[model samples]
Target: MGSRNGKILFALVGVCLLVGAGYVVAAALGPDETTTEARPQVDGAVLAHAHLMVRAVDPANPRLNGRVYEIDGGKARRRSGDLACERVYFAGGRGICMGVAPSGVDYRAQIFDSQLRPVHEFALTGFPSRARVSSDGRYGATTVFVSGDSYLQAPSAFSTRTVIVDLRSGERVGQLEQFDVTKDGKPFDAVDFNFWGVTFVPGDSSRYYATLGTGGSHYLVEGDIAARSMRVLRDGVECPSLSPDGEQIVFKSRVAGSERWRLRVLDVETLADHAVAETRSVDDQVEWLDNETLVYSYEDDLYTVPADGSGEPQLLVRDASSPVRLDRGI
Candidate 1:
């Protein structure tokens, strides 16, 4: 049984490597350079209700880093400063932007203020995959894909590293890989453990949830910052984002036999989940528009659906990805 499972794991890793390589190539050969800057146009109803911070997706080249823009009161305007990123998230009054550094070869993360001015900058070890800031702007998390650095020091082609940063001092708090994990009341350790897609709890900066990928399963794990420990909650949940009320979690449910996912909402307490109205294979971490609706990017466009699993998907914004809800009194 162990040998058979091992073979399956190896096969899964190969598929993952191929997918990762394809992403790397697409990122490298980014969209053709065009003078036009991508801007987000929001639906009138959506604009009247929600304020959003989004990274514009260039029509000519959706892969290129687009300028940050804010949509409020039906007006779409570029952010004050020059902040463009591949993945972005903002909360409280701070934001995290991950993109190519000035050297152009290395990637970096920039901590910016509400005005979009970069307050601190640091180099990232690999390509940025996810970024999040706690609700109070006290801390931030980043996940990057690094090569040849699996937890067991194996010769794997790809692995992920998630780092928690203290936003106040702009210093590293700890790496998720160094934390302790428990599953089923027993210490759970594995060579293929990779962590990503962290979504901080609404009011608590120290408590959060993230996805733990190992042995062909993606488990949702609750983590503690001060304790530096995590416990497996359940399986088949990825890239979880807690609602503003923190009562529910919206995550991506992977479709079997394919690299695609469907949006699902689960009770944070009961762990019971239901699928949303969107039937497309969304690959991004979803954001809550207002607890009643969910917003996410698919194929470089942003869409919204009812959180209660009703109503059809609606196009919220065009040529936009990385949509961040701006309702946290920021």
Candidate 2:
């Protein structure tokens, strides 16, 4: 019995290592990386009654993608899971914004009804792999690649663009280009380089953030659509996530030459930050439970801590992967 259990442990640990490795590679090679806002008050009555919308990927097809699940009454059951849910978020309990990975190079944004079926087949096309749904459920945004011929061997650069779509009308409002993150906006010239992990500012319609990597150094830049410009927020901000109320940003940072991932939270207004967690593997895919509590995926498990960078992180789930999604019951 002991031997059997040991094998199981080894297998699970190995899986986590693989997933962590993948994220590390992506972050190292991808574009480089928010401040946060104050959280709103909620009743204890609300959190106890909260349920979530999530993906219960069929472990049988770990690499093949996953299906969607709804967490109700502390039980996670299959809601659909057929869509390869990359981003699962809710807006006012009326609609869902999902980033679906249909293929390696392409992802689509789709809106869904309460029943978990596609409300429209082609709501937004050429959607970036990384995206988030708006708080009201009416708009969706993402980062996508703009490929072209290159004169040198520089990798392809992807532009972080926001495609605003009205869920009710099933129409794309428009795709505004936010930032050009290709090593000072270099055009693609080779197959070895690319981009990933695009996150938009929470409720901030004019701005978004992405990691731009080239020549081996990664930088995080914020995009301003109205100005048609991109600005580096911090030199090495990575794995940024907003708090539930969308006022706080949680991210990992590197100090000088150290490759260690140290988690930090910043005040959006004052730019004051509180450091919270330290991780050996690259920590990414964090979310907010409320404005006070934060959740992030580490070693194939999801853990939570205070938003102001306080306390030891408590485990939420294991055997899970990034692009972890959470609803604030908003």
Candidate 3:
């Protein structure tokens, strides 16, 4: 008697759910309603997750004089050092200009147009340091190093708060929010490797990941730029990159006394991790080509490997660092 009653109750509840779903479908997604994924609204073309180039800082070849070679080509061509990222890879054809610190300037900042032409120039008012693009590539955030007076001993130079601003308009986007944690959340101490590079939440465009090195500890930080608070994920880490589908993160880590940075993969949702590669030196750069393959730079050459770390890493260049995969206009 009890089993029969339970079966009847389940069937009635299922029927009610089906009726509700039918109503929702009929009302919400009628014949005329069209839903499109929120992507590529800027200029109609969906921007690539990352862009890269491999040409010549030095070149001497008959067939490959000085041209930008796409990574897909597996070779180089003749192109000038002044070639834009868009021209080399096929995104920003209008030209992009990178800011390089002049002989007497305080720092270097690279700026380019849609076609990658050097249309603007400026020197940072603070100490010289590192700079990188925002998640959307719409802004640039830089760390400025300054010398602080230390009466206790020898002179010392240190890096302070990071500054972020518009990459296109050259306007101040405001300073980066300092990371803070409570007893319940996670506390962090900012270090050199922390803030190495910032990556964003895929598709949504807002919220992002930041790596922090503090007090000999490194942590993965999730922050809402507009909210001002942060949550820490993993510690003793660097170079956090989001997968294209926004499902995973590939970062650099050094466990225990090991000096080498091992590539680690994490399920962004579950926060589980596994080692993918180990280079004697720090493995600072990692970008996922798809969910399964990742492209990274070690020493001067760029190599691509499976996210599972199954096969050997095939070299894409002899002397290419900072590799980001961009479309070949195909």
Candidate 4:
């Protein structure tokens, strides 16, 4: 009986050793959590005119999370230090990176400096969708998907919450949902009102524009930061981005009966818009590479088209999104 028990003990020990070995092998083959560099291959000549900040998109898993990269002189290099984001934007020497918090369960936003080092971090209410900084780097805005509040009862239904942030102090300025909105010089309030895609005017940080989604209509609403009021300018505009010169506004015009959108450029003064050369539906807050050109992401790649509704779409950077033009010396 003693010899039989000894044989059984030896068998159990062997099984444990095999299990441990398998775990070690699996650990070695798993995805590396420490690696943050994307090392994208891009043409230097295309980016030589201006430095741009973008987030790398994983081809296999295109979640919003990725390492931040700077494209300059046709080269793409991952920013040094640890800063990975799901949505990233930089302007006027400040940047906002929204992603999952270190706890791995909640979302957060980190306000960073010109060196890409985080100076302040704040909690985010939901999944990060869009992030932007004012041209002068004085203020920032973030949009998140809040699941339970969707007016649409579909399975994929979701609502959005956009908030303005004071960049210097890293404090919450105001929530767009709480601000008063107007249409035609009268108060406009609705239970289904949702706001997103905030774009600050080029020279005026106190004034901004955003899309107000309500009653199945998307309106371009101009807002005043100090007054906490927004006045609807026009309808059918989403993700409005003003040009560097602040004369033209580029936005995504949603297609009828579809989730797709076509890029369109509008005169800020005239409010007349025309389709851009790119026929594909883009669902991004367009970025202006310059006064004459527009850049945006589609299918995990960056593309540029002329702001004048001429020229075909050109691929700018591969496997990158959240393109922020760095022309302001940041």
Q: Rate the local accuracy (lDDT) of all candidates.
A: 0.81, 0.47, 0.47, 0.79
Q: Which candidate model has the greater lDDT, 1 or 3?
A: 1
lDDT digits (tens) for residues 1-330 of candidate 1: 111111112234544575365356445552343113767877655646768899988766665567898877767889855788878999988899987665545678999998889999888988778999999999999988776542333455566779999987889999887788899999887766778899999889999999988888899999999999999999999899999999999999988987778899999989999999999888788998897999899887888899999999988788889989997345
lDDT of 2: 0.47
Worst 10 residues of 2 by lDDT: 1-10
lDDT of 4 by residue, 80-117 (tens): 56898878999888899987666555678999999999
Candidate 1 minimal-lDDT segment of 10 residues: 1-10
Please identify which of the two predictions, 2 or 3, would achieve the higher TM-score against the true structure.
3
What TM-score does each of the candidates earn?
0.89, 0.61, 0.65, 0.87
For all predictions, the C-alpha RMSD in Å is 4.4, 12.5, 21.3, 14.3
**Pairwise lDDT winner, candidates 1 and 2:** 1
TM accuracy, model 3 = 0.65
- Per-residue lDDT of 101-207 in model 3, one digit per residue for the tens? 33422233446544445545455544322344544566555544333323212233233345555666766655544434322454533223224456667544347
Q: What does candidate 2's lDDT look like per residue over 1-330, in tens digits?
A: 111100001112332354344333333331211001111122222234235554433333332234555544544555554444444555533344443334343345566765666776453343223455555455554433332224222222222234545567777654433223333454322222223344556666556564544334445656555554555555555556666555667777655555456788876565467788544444454666667776655544455666664566665544343333445433
TM-score attained by model 2: 0.61
Best by TM-score: 1
Which window of ten consecutive residues has the lowest lDDT sum in model 4? 1-10
- Candidate order, TM-score descending: 1, 4, 3, 2
Residue 165, candidate 3: alpha-carbon lDDT: 54
Query: What ranges in model 3 sit over 4 Å off?
Result: 1-51, 55-72, 77-99, 104-106, 124-135, 143-161, 177-183, 186-194, 328-330
